[model samples]
Target: MKLSWSVEKNNQLKAHPDRGICFEDIVAAIDHGGLLDDVAHPNADRYPGQRVLVVFCNGYVYGVPYVQQDDGTLFLKTAFPSRLLKKRYMGGDDNGKKS
Candidate 1:
């Protein structure tokens, strides 16, 4: 399948080796979320089982989701590294903590 990386994702892949997640790692994580069927269905089964979550390449966990809407178009919702364990906590409830 063809994967699209955002401008920030491209930058992270270039300047900060530790700041960005690999294409392989992204595939692995997505596989765990059961979203791989769409890719592996017609392909050579490259990604078997993947999950769908936001992806953050700012050297953090809690994926910044790249969602494929019902219309079959793709989009990037979050462009920053995860500031908390989960994206839901990004509701500014950190009390000014830079985490």
Candidate 2:
């Protein structure tokens, strides 16, 4: 998976020395270990057509914010740890067993 980082993302990574989320982790998520969110965030007005990919790594859920460029490259806008795990991705009610 190829990802072009935004300036903010680079800065965020630099500012947070303890956070383990990195380029390699994002690549892994894109390739084989993540979920493509059906919901596109409306909050990111700066990034038009932004999409979110959620990945579970090291017991944490990372929401990777990105956009697909016209040239077909994925531009990674930013990422952060999510407070709640999305139900579908976690095999919750709609996807899993029903009581």
* TM-score between candidate 2 and the true structure: 0.64
Q: What is the lDDT of residue 55 in candidate 2?
A: 71
Which runs in model 2 stand beyond 4 Å of their true positions?
6-11, 14-18, 36-38, 44-46, 86-88, 91-99
Tens digits of per-residue lDDT for model 2 on 1-99? 557876666767657755556756666765675655635765767666888777765545667777888888888766666655445455433222111
Identify the candidate with maximal lDDT.
Answer: 2
Assess the local accuracy of residue 67 in candidate 1 as a C-alpha lDDT between 0 and 100: 49
lDDT at 2 for candidate 1?
32
TM-score of each: 0.36, 0.64
lDDT of 1: 0.42
Error of 2 at 28 (Å): 1.8
Assess each prediction's global lDDT (C-alpha) against the native: 0.42, 0.63
